[model samples]
Target: MNLRVPTAWFLSGNRSDSNYTVGVNNTVVGFQESEDLRIAHDVITNSILVLIILGMGCGITLDQFKLHLRRPTGVAIGLLSQTVVLPFASFALAHSLGLETEAAVGMMVMGVTPCGMMSTVFSYWVDGDVSLSFTISILSTLLAFGTIPLNLLIYSGSWTDKQFVIPYSSILVLVGMTTMPLLLGIFIRWRLPKVASVILKIGSYAGILLVALSLVMLSVLYPFMYWASWKIYIAAISYPYISFMFGYVVSALFKMENFRRRTIALETGMQNFTLCFAILEASFSHVTSDVMSVFPLLYGVNVRTAGFVFVGIYKFMEKYGPKPVLTEEAHHLKHANNHRESFRLEDQQTSKGFLDSEAAEENGES
Candidate 1:
């Protein structure tokens, strides 16, 4: 009744020869004795990654970019929390928890990846700053090419025994996958708004389908025991909540409004897990890839659970709690409306007074 699962059962072909390695001198090496199924799997996964990026880009617009940039404080804080704080948090957690090499590296990868659309959706649910959420999502993704490699180089090396050269080619492919589709999506949004909407829907649904297929594949290939480790569960469950708290604290310390604070917190907590999965699958051996994949899978589930809990609490409070106070902008708008109404009444009285005086003069003269 041994529950421990071997990687060979999941991945076809011999595990020993399937290791894809880069030399210390940054040489790119091919997979030895690679099977066609593995190659096809890689291609499909990368394609799905591209589509997901495209869908994300489609959700953004130049207007959002300009709006957030005009007031850059919130955006700056968000990027700092995302690229700097989250990675540091993950690195610390992995080391603190004493995760093994694959899990540690997985945690690092999850940290460095950009925020996903789920953050935006969760922001909306929790009455967060949705505009700011969109801005952070797009900007973080655009900057991911540079930030991801830098973060990986800075943190991932320590977790592994081998020299982890920066994966320039894979990153370049990521850049192309991210940038080109993003720009195309933006252009479609600008030129053909209707078409872009369709693309967005298609991309989202297709991406979900592909990810579901991948999970099914993983479940079928890798047994339940592969994911039964206590370390993985602890790291996955705590990671998002820790990230959420850090994001809130950082934004609150900067004196951000509550909505924006919530937005940043969600953005920081929810990492783009699909992208992380794709990177690990491409970069590591089948065994390592399979092992690392567990972190994101578990993380994705737990993060969503945290999001739902937050949303539920928010709804409960909104329903039963005290009436919410007006925000600064709303207060100003209310004051402006009241002032305008007073001016309108004064103008009407003045006109009436002038007409009455003229009528009296005319009557007297008559």
Candidate 2:
């Protein structure tokens, strides 16, 4: 369950360098295939994914979800912003930027995938409404199962130029890989809370190591990738920052509270990279390898870096920005003090009464 994010100091370095090409042939493992390194990196990514699911599962609870139903408008707004608005925006960005078709498709897929596990972490960090964030994340992901295929078909309709067709066999791929695991995680969380908690904690620590390992790879890998990145964006790294500012500004234009604003910001900024990666792995074939049409695997690192950057930013912002109200915490502190005072007063009264009663008894006996 250890799925810590890869480190993202690279966020500030230069996504625009276009110096780092991520083509199909450009294995992230570097020039030499080094099966050992490839296996290690694969293990890290898989662990990161498992940890992410575990953390998300641990963050969720079924008991009080119904309470939010009474305030359906907010829920609706959160949902609409996520599933509807976000996908369209992602498409627009990719299309207008004139991204290669697969890149555009991949970016759009990232948008459609829904709020990430980090949304909960960022929500809590930014003092945003964690419950609402979790609720929005879960609902949007549930909705994605139906909407993603539709979006993919619509956007990539002409893929082989002969009205490209899906094998329908891949539906099983989507379900088995993404949807089923997610549901399994949720079921475990609901039915076996302690197990979920342990998995989630492990995932969190794993995520940290993943981030560290990613950062190290980027440092070692970038200088050699100059040949492949000829046409990709020189400004791709900055997109996350721009996206954050835009989402924050847009959320603020509405009358949202501090925490909700944080939720919107982080949710809006981070893409679900795993979804895009899974689709590329599943849908594309080896024959189309170089002309494979999907983006270079290096983009995965970019996506991870962006998500982690926002998480760190949020962790810092949570301190100065809005926070969850301490109603329960305050109530408990007050109750404890009241109980203590009551105990002290009762002890004093009992002691005086006992003393007076003993004197009276002595007088009577005398």
lDDT of each: 0.66, 0.51
Against the true structure, candidate 1 reaches a TM-score of: 0.63
Candidate 1 structure quality by residue, lDDT tens digits, 164-269: 3334464445446656777777677567655655676566566556556555544443343243357777888898888888888888998887777888888889
Identify the runs in model 2 with alpha carbons over 4 angstroms from their true place: 1-40, 48-60, 69-75, 157-204, 214-231, 246-254, 287-299, 311-366
**lDDT, candidate 2, 100-170, per-residue tens:** 55455545556666555555554544445545665666666666667676666665542332232333444
Indicate the TM-score of model 2.
Answer: 0.59
For all predictions, the C-alpha RMSD in Å is 13.6, 14.3
Where does candidate 2 have its weakest 10-residue lDDT segment?
1-10
